[model samples]
Target chain A: MLARLNVALLGLLASTLSFAGDAISATEKQPLNLHAIGMFVLFVSMTLGITYWAAGRTKSASDFYTAGGGITGFQNGLAIAGDYMSAATLLGLTALVYTKGVDGYIYMIAFFAGWPIILFLMAERLRNLGKFTFADITSYRLNQSKVRTMAAVSSLTVVCFYLVAQMVGAGQLIKLLFGLDYNIALFVVGALMMVYVTFGGMVATTWVQIIKACMLLAGGTLVAVLAMSQFGFSFEKMMGQAVSLHSLGEKLLFPGTLLPDPITALSLGLGLMFGTAGLPHILMRFFTVTNAKEARKSVLYASGFVAYFFNVILLMGFAAIIIVGQNPEFFEGGQIGGKIVGGGNMIAMHLAKAVGGNLLLGFLSAVAFATILAVVSGLALAGAAAISHDIYARVIRKGKATETEELRVSRFASVGLGLVAIVLGIAFEKMNVAFMVALAFGIAASANFPVLILSMYWKGLTTRGAVAGGYAGLVAAVLLVVFSKSVWVTVLGNAEALFPYDQPALFSMPLAFLITFIVSKLDNSAEAQAERAAFEDQYVRAQTGFGAAEASSH
Target chain B: MSTTASQNAVYARIRKNPRFAELVSKRQGFATLLSIIVLVIFYGFFMVVAFNPNLIGQRLSEGSYVTIGIAAELFMFIFFWVLTAVYVKRANGEFDEITAEIVRDASKEVK
Candidate 1:
């Protein structure tokens, strides 16, 4: 009964993105490619096999949420890297570099700047304090009902926006790769995601991510190396040719073209930096490790892999500027220097074809599809945990729910979120939802980051302060985005935007911190006193792992 | 469990231990220092991009197509990665040792 409903939901979502118009018009009516479909089928079959194995082992809440905390640091690191480097980074950033030149590299730097800081500041304390979700840490000593509800609300918001963006992108992607209708593509992705999370849970999800990461890293390296071979493996040679061919010419090497203003640059940089630290899916990776030591190692390995992959993507983009830019076959109607076949985002795939022909392109296409699948699975799981663990078990049940009951709720929540993502994806197809990704980051930085940091490092934080600050950040981010140029002028057809900046982190993040600090200072009730007093034990556990939640002994 | 008298006593003792203070202060200082360094490096790059786009656009030397900004960022990516390794080495080694000793001392006091 539920499976039929899920399929219906996916059909609705797929049709929605089909009408999304410009967002995915590149592959609107393409025919199926047998090679691409075959490769993707192979991936789906293998992952489903892994899910079958994982479901047998997933007998408890811990296993479902975190693979029983038995994952080694290195494995967890790859999964984290897999989670972070979505299809957007692989395809969208490459397109950015392909067009904007050095500006794309600048964006990559901003995206990457968050990891080392996460390691230095949050990873250990997070591992020591959190059990299943980030709510574990925020509600550790505060009012469970209030704090958990706030965290769950913000988490679901971030997840839903992000999930919709991914689902819409997935429909477009499947159209390009497999020649399937957008609705059919959405159904396949939505169904696979639900099956992975509802049955296989985190263990299946992590392994899928790990496999996709390997494919992406390998596929990306192959494209870069093969393309760079055309330039005889010299960075200077590749840049020299790319600069001469690009329309921007020498200006491609500069920063002024993409981000002319300092405020916008700073806002974008801050949003990507701190927002990365607060993402629930990323934070949940820390709890999968055995201890604080393994958690620290996860960040170290994840950062290394991500930094290296971004650099490889830089090479692929530069190589594409020369390889794909010069080739007429990959262009629309063989018009050189004109429209690309699969839109601007297909530059990476075109470069693969130019270097290694159809086989490599087919492989990269499968990798891209797999990347989307892995990322959405992680997002769905995080969203589900927020519902089952935070809202249902802690808030609604008053922490009286049994383990089996909690796990069952989580499975239902996973399916429920997957359906919501499909419905929203379809409903917002023509709404210019490109702003959702930036909005997600803004909320993460504003609503989630401030309260999370203060709860761990500050003893003055009370339930009233944390809850108020969290909502302030959430509302401020959403309102700012609604009034910003992206939504106000482009989507809403307003004459002028209420907010000038596209990124809201600079203004809203500080506002959240200030509210949290002031409200905490004014709090003077006995409950506030008890919350402050309990901070010592939380601090001890956070510091030394004494009496911290332990890994289940299997 | 945290409200139980014995657990509370153990936590109080842990807080009172001299090594516990040392661990928290040392680790906190190191983490703050590293975090500041990262913020400076990242924000410095952004500030330069905002104020002086031309400087970053210029080639490392005349006649080279590779600009200073791209090259610097590539190195910074690797450099940021090395920073993670540096903190982890000290943290998983020295800081973790201090944490273990503090826990042991606190538990002994409770007994």
Candidate 2:
């Protein structure tokens, strides 16, 4: 079975290469239009203006970090969509479904399934506890310094991985859509994202995300509608055509079955579902809402919007499969004759170009660019907040710093983080964006999620426990991922990898939880009785959102 | 400590109000149970798919004739919305009341 799967994959690869060659030769003379560039500029300008307008209202650290906690449910809903729906969702999933059939929907299922966990468990508590960062919650009962250090490290790690992925994606999208060099695209996207985040903070970043989400959904839906219309509004016919042409069989709907093993299937599922809850960028959005209820509402809205958008993307992918398959000339030839042009990420863009001409193509391309920018900006902000607010003000300075000073440091951190991302993006431009994303998710799940879950529910959870658990998860996940086949072979170009593990969830997550549990048991009496009482009071306050209101009333 | 106990009493009173208690108890259980069922059914379906990939594979080429795959996908979408609607409703009613009670209790403690 393994040999057969390998042979089949190789065959598919050969066909894909040929398709790429054909596509490149056929579209070699097709130049990018200035009209697309004009539309791109107009869209960018509008989003930037909104961001700038919002930034003007940001007068304090709270405003800079959480938009003064004034974002409406509807507005925050759109921003949530913007933040969660990245270039990967817009393009990669569409392309995957286009090429691989049902396997593509795995991404959608995993992404959406994680929301319930967020809604029921994380969102409200997160909103009520820490003002901005995950560190706030984990470090609540523990020593603030230990919490800050672990939280910052985790946030930075996730943000760096996520930013690099978005940057790499931006480079690819620019090359495909604008016919520009990958390096130029990466540089342009990096600069734009840095400016938007550094200048506007959460306020600007939120609006930019909202605009990007709207465009991606609209653009993706339009293509799906067009594709369905071509099939006389029949999804069944589209699937039929896909299955007939591709012979995807059960693998179309049940992902990893195509991989010749159940372990791979489970790994993919775990990665998608658990990874969503742990993503730093996604988790940070909980802090943007005013209250726990609003936070819950935001998740509901985000889930609904994301599910709807993904359905449209699913249709778009099926459309591409049928449409592109019907016309083999559409395939770009590389080392083989049947492979599609670019990687799996280019399917949606190619579909737009196929159906809507260069104008639609350009529009979608610009939306893709916006998608990368919005995601990276949010990531940069999270990284900055973790450093400035969580570490510097709360931990290092021991809450002595003024709000003004904190805001200054946060803005500076944003700039620094953005520059770091730009450099990394340029450096790793050739790597797969999805791998970077997966690595971030792995780290987040192993390190942050355990710390978050344990701290919120476990009253006995001590500072030592959190630190031990957090660092353990962080180190274990990073080490496992670095040694995994995907990173070692794919990213580092080393065939002989040390560790056989591809997914770190089965090991690192449990290890982190175990370490935390043991440490908490040992440090049970370390916290003073008075401090323990105060901490219990804080937990109730955090859970109820009464803490802040009670403080203000006093 | 006595002040905190008194505050807790008032909170318990607010929580124990017949209408509020009934609503809170019913909705909280309902939400929790519904969420569990949704997650179970969602994962259960995936588990089935994992174990039996051929369940929907045969219907792939059936073409607009209401195949199992299409039905399953539609069911999943509907299930998702049902869960969302349940959450929104319960959040507005039971969860909101509990939060209000807690807020009131905390405020009294401050006084």
Number of the top lDDT candidate: 1
Which lDDT tens digits does candidate 2 get at residues A235-311?
66776676666656435654443334455555555666667777777887777777767777887788888889988
Q: Could you list the CA RMSD of all candidates, in the order they appear?
A: 3.4, 8.7
Which stretches of model 1 miss by more than 4 angstroms? A1-27, B1-3
Off by over 4 Å in 2: A1-30, A247-260, A333-337, A496-498, A528-535, A549-554, B1-31, B58-70, B105-110
The positional error of residue A359 in candidate 2, measured at the CA in angstroms, is: 1.8
Provide the DockQ value for model 1: 0.79
Write model 1 residue lDDT over A353-417, tens digit each, in one string: 89989899899999999999999999999999999999999999998999999999999999998
The digit string of per-residue lDDT tens for model 1 on B45-111 reads: 9999999988889788888876789878988898899999999999999999989888888888899
Alpha-carbon local distance difference test for all models: 0.90, 0.72
